[model samples]
Target chain A: MTIGSQVKQSLANMKAIHATLQQLALTSTNEEAQRAFHEAMLETEQMIAALKGRISTLEREEPQYKGM
Target chain B: MPAWLEVAIRSICILIGLFIITKLLGKKQLSKLSFFEYIVGITIGDIAGTMSMDLDIRLTEGVTSILIWALFPVAISHISLRSKKFRDFVEGNSTVFIKNGKILEDNLKKEKYTADELLEQLRKKDVFRVADVEFATLEANGDLSILLKRDKQPLTIGDIKPYVPEEKEPQTVIMDGKILDEPLATARLNRGWLKQQLDQMGVAIENVFLAQVDSYGQLTVDLYDDRIQLPEPQQKQLLLASMKKAEADFELFSLQTNDAEAKQMYEQQAKHMQQLIQKLQPFLM
Candidate 1:
């Protein structure tokens, strides 16, 4: 997939994961589950950053893909 | 080990122990901490901090004290987990503030919530009119979860248009080239059907970025391709808007009036939210 597409998918996944973490924050009965959700949410943010970086790099290089 | 490494090891051990103790404490401990919990948190952290750094005092003594004190909350949590009444004792039950469109002044008094706090919570919930609430309760996590009047609530699918449940939706058989073995049986869907569905979509299992059968059992397919699509300005705005809305809703639902409960819940949510915001900050960068 293109870096742009990868960034989009990663962003979407991060959003979903954040939503789930919110739910877990309020609904999870166990403290560890809440911690896990929080950790996963962090990992998602990192992935988003990495993907966005890739997208920006591609936007700078790709000539035909004016979709930047 | 070097001095710094020794300190690091001590810090990690202390952290793990704290984590276990925190986990045993339950949802309210993280979400609705009282003054008592704060004392415990401080005391444990203090001891851990001292243990990791102090050369004169030994680590065992500090850890033992922390563990000994931990047993009280731990035992209470265990009992609460097994028995509903004990749960009520340890975490307290949600008090009905407004039941059947009427305010329960006694409960409000018991929960130490002022009329102003109630109004604030309602405003956060987007309920400007107090009469709009059918039931409002102070949930265990110190949230003012309000159930609005039935007439005021948005109509559900069944209410708007009557129809029986349709066929179950297909599941995402492949995600990032990994077969979800657990979801297959849990969802009562198998590989052959999923493969056929992918075949129709011309999505190779390896190329499938994320495929999950949604709740409706519909296969929601996301493919990996050399395509361009950064969240346009509008989509980005929408994404942020929704996240903000969710946070506002949570603030409304999770309100604690009791000073002890208020402090605890605030700290818990603050710590949790701080971590979350910090994590998301990188993406914002």
Candidate 2:
């Protein structure tokens, strides 16, 4: 896979993980478990943002790799 | 029927029949023939031999059988040229076994090739490391076409320095002291210009053994005798070569640029290079 495609896939997976963690945090009764799930959601969101940046950069640079 | 009489008549008839069939089938080298075509050729020959030696089979029947065998292959060849999917089914499409230094194990397995066999093919291309290959494909004829990674490819002058010589195909203008009309037309020079060049050297055109012209309009001549020395290289030819290289570089630059302003500049540069080449053509060599 190209770097762009890989970064796009990572962004998709991070989004899915963040959705699951958000659901877990909302339903959990224990304070510690809720806090852990919220923290996981925050990390996943950050990773998704980083991957979006990488995907944009890679998409811009993709043409330079042609004919190589 | 008399045995000797039957044998002689059958032999002559079969010979004529096979000769006519072969002529209609057209010419193709045995090495280039596909497996089905090869089988068809051999089976036709075998049927002809059988018909010639056997007394039971009628001459007309044997000829008809051979014709049927010949027609299938010729028809298939014609159809294969027109239909790409049929041609791929018949002769097999080229398969990519390696891409971006990664070996596709499923493709290798599907082609019934082992890892060792793939390595052997790589070795034939002088590539010992699998990591050095950017793309390696098995061609339709089972030949391997390998493209190495950019870092592993042989370095050209353009890679080391900023120089790219004009690489034009040498066109033969004269052979055996005879001027070739086609190349003269291709080089865009008249017979009068050639005569003037020969007259300036105190030589006749008939005395020249071989002559070639390059893209830079440089004429390389060889005389039948060893008495006459060739002229030295001129500045105009070098200038033309540089202009040709510049034109090619500008074309490549235009393809690589994404910026609109840079692309316009590159296109303009390429146009100027082409103009320089046109301007320098008359004075070269």
Candidate 3:
């Protein structure tokens, strides 16, 4: 698979993981468990955001890539 | 046991090997490298670094790893160049975020870009208003390519100037005292005509440094000695005739065009050309 597609797939995976973590954070009775899940979800969201930025960067460079 | 000497020799070998491999790879700058290539470069550098300093690993083992890392990227790059599918897989496709002054919401969502970010990008392109953009694409390299709407685009010489001269490409007839046959043919002139021109300028073909014929069939010759000065002749009649033809064409366009804006533009052009002709009348006399 292309690096771009892999990054996109990773982004999707991260989003799914983030949604699950959010749900877990809400359902957890223990305050510590809830906080940890929330933190993990935030980190996953950040990763997804970074992946989106990477995809945009790759898309922008395509014309030069074609010339190469 | 002089283990230090062996380590030093191994380090030198690794350095030389990495240098040669790097030179073998084409001179694509780090900034120009795609994400995959960038990762490959880092991996290769890491392998080289491990080989250079680590005494625990066998020198041959490290060198082999380095070669594999470097050659794999080169091979992939070759394959990518040969296959469009491979290239597309390696580099994602660019998406159009805006088309015909309308924001492509679906595409924006797919790209995970917010409408506010799109507006910011448009602003960076000097497009203050979204309505002014005809098309805006988010390229794979993260660049925003924008085309302004027709009416919003900056005016060119053709928009205001009455006379739009015919587009003609210049042809080189001679270079370094040697007459190029292909350019001469492209210019639709023979050696005889070239020789005649050279004779008119009192220059021999062997002494001519460069000679080019412009679209208007005007010849400019430069000599190797740089002593000769060629006088440029101004033809008042040619200019007057072209002006008159342009005035007539604009008047004709104004009559035939049904588009209000185009008709108005043509009328204004005709008026401008008429004024130009009047100003040139004294010069013609």
Candidate 4:
């Protein structure tokens, strides 16, 4: 997959997870489940950061998107 | 008369101001007051006293004095939050006072407390006999914390002696005037079991306020209709904690005369009475 497309997919996944986390935080009465969701959100955030860095690198380099 | 009244008002206001400033300087949270806090408290008290009596001193002057006295501790607290070095220097670490009943004089000296004072504090903890102590610590806040020797301490269920449960009595089948189906189901006891227990006791579930299953599976129930047996410990402690309030009111009322002896006597007695309530705390719990 192209770097830009991959980044877009990651962002989309992070948003979905973030939304689910908010819902889980409210609905889950168990403290452990809520904490797990929060930790999941943090991990997704880190992944998004890493994916964005790669996309920026792709954009910076001239037309490297095409061949490899 | 208005001028005399204003003067009287200012005097009272000064006392309030001093109290506020000292309280705001924040000693209540900590068991020990630091040197800086102690100094700030004393200085504010002195300034409030002087400013109240001096007719020339304005309210603004008192405010500024209180504010100035207050700033040091606030600043110190802020720094202590961010700086570990400053925190350690301000409130020294806890020191071991006794290790297996061996008195550590050096720690006592560091705490600036005499041996007699340590013994007095221990006695207050009902550990008058030092040999009975296993570990004693001079906590950073100037409080003495003790770990007593094994035999001197109250034996818990896991001690040398063991008592086996005799029988499983009817578990708590109802609480707050409602039948507890879940607990009954979990305990494998049924409605018939509950009905029989209630029938034997000649009381209905609707009258119960609280119910619990003890370790031996016996149901302990408290009823709103029942004249509950509140054992002597609770009654005695409540009685003691409240007795001094009347004395406190008398002392507060006699503040009009401003007699130093009366004030000191009242304060001392109130403290003594409070300590008694504090000692009775375990029983209350």
Best by TM-score: 1
Q: Model 2 off-target regions past 4 Å?
A: A1-68, B1-33, B38-70, B156-168, B226-285
The alpha-carbon deviation from the true structure for residue B126 of candidate 3, after best TM-score superposition, in angstroms, is: 4.5
- Quick one: best DockQ, which candidate? 1
The list of candidate 3 runs beyond 4 A from truth reads A1-68, B1-85, B104-126, B154-168, B176-178, B188-190, B202-209, B215-217, B222-285
Residue B119, model 1, lDDT: 97
What TM-score goes with each of the models? 0.54, 0.52, 0.43, 0.41
TM-score for chain A, candidates 1 onward in order: 0.68, 0.83, 0.83, 0.69
Global lDDT of model 2: 0.70
lDDT of 4 by residue, B164-200 (tens): 2222334566777888888777665567766776676
**Per-model root-mean-square deviation over C-alphas:** 24.6, 25.6, 31.9, 31.2
> What lDDT tens digits, residue by residue, belong to model 4 across residues A1-68?
55445445544544554555454444333445445445544654554464455446546663666333
Clash count per candidate: 16, 0, 12, 0
Identify the superior model by TM-score, candidate 1 or candidate 3: 1
lDDT of 2 by residue, B37-153 (tens): 778888999999999898888878887888789898888889988999999888778899998789999999989999999999999989999999999999876788999999899
lDDT of 1 by residue, A1-68 (tens): 45345445544655665665554443333344445546756654554464455446556667565463
User: Best-fitting candidate, measured by lDDT?
Assistant: 2
Superposed by TM-score, candidate 1 places the C-alpha of residue B178 at a distance from the truth, in angstroms, of 1.9
Pull out the clashing pairs in model 2.
none
The per-candidate TM-score of the B chain, in the order shown, comes to 0.65, 0.62, 0.50, 0.48
